[model samples]
Target: MTLSVRRARTNDVPSIHQLLDYYAARGQLLPRSPDELTEHISSFTVINEADNLTGCAALEVFTEDLGEVRSLAVRDAATGGGYGRALVEEIEHNARTIGLRRLMALTYVPDFFARLGYGVVAMNTLPEKVFGVCVTCPKFRCCDEIAVLKHLD
Candidate 1:
């Protein structure tokens, strides 16, 4: 199957929410409602082979130069097929297009990001994420996700 990544559209919300819920239920990613996905659809990128949605990710800009890679997930059957990497590459492209100089992700799979040039970083180093966003996360006090960052050219 040929996979291609592109900007998300309004009609993709249900599929995106389902894909996110699949990982969220396994505690591999955060859960996002269909409404939330729809509201931020412009920030998302999706990978599909023909009409089947395989993976998705979003670039959440926090500042003029900083953005976070959020809600990255791939279909269980599609994992290891490079769709995840494609989705993130799309996100990085989107971030750079918007003039972001840095991209960060809070992930359980730091190695995946590392393969894409991300480096491990302390959560506290990102106050915009720590105070502005983490404070609202249910796992804030017991967060186990590692923070990873990459500098964009």
Candidate 2:
């Protein structure tokens, strides 16, 4: 199946929420409410095939030089089809277009990020990330998610 990655529209919010909810429920990522999705809707990209949402990802800017890839998820039926990679590439493209120097993710799939040119880094090194969101996580003191970053420059 051919997939196209595009900037998400307001109408796509429900699909994005559902995709994130699927993975979040399985402990792969954090669950985001529709309100939160609306707040950051502009940061998102969705992969669609013939009008069907196949996957989605978002890039949340933390600073002029840094951004975080969040809420990345691919439908179970869409795995191994490069939808995830395409979504990340789309996010990277946006990051570069906006002049960001780095892109990061807190993920369980370190190998996937590594394949996309990201390197694993210590969570402690990312103060902006830790203080901004990690602090509010229930797993803050014992987080197992790995920090990975890719230089965009």
- Model 2 shows how many backbone clashes? 0
Instruction: Give the per-residue lDDT digits (tens) of candidate 2, residues 1-153.
Output: 566889999999999898889888899999999999998899999999989999999999988899999999999988998888999999999999999999999999999999999999998888989999788989999899999999998
Predicted candidate 1 versus true structure: per-residue lDDT over 4-26, tens digit per residue: 78889999999999999989999
**In model 1, what is the error at residue 125, expressed in angstroms?**
0.6
Model 2, stretches more than 4 Å misplaced? none
Worst 10 residues of 2 by lDDT: 1-10
lDDT of model 1, residue 147: 98
lDDT of 2: 0.92
- Which pairs, if any, clash in model 1? none
User: What Cα-based lDDT does every candidate model obtain?
Assistant: 0.92, 0.92
What lDDT score is found at residue 47 in candidate 1? 88
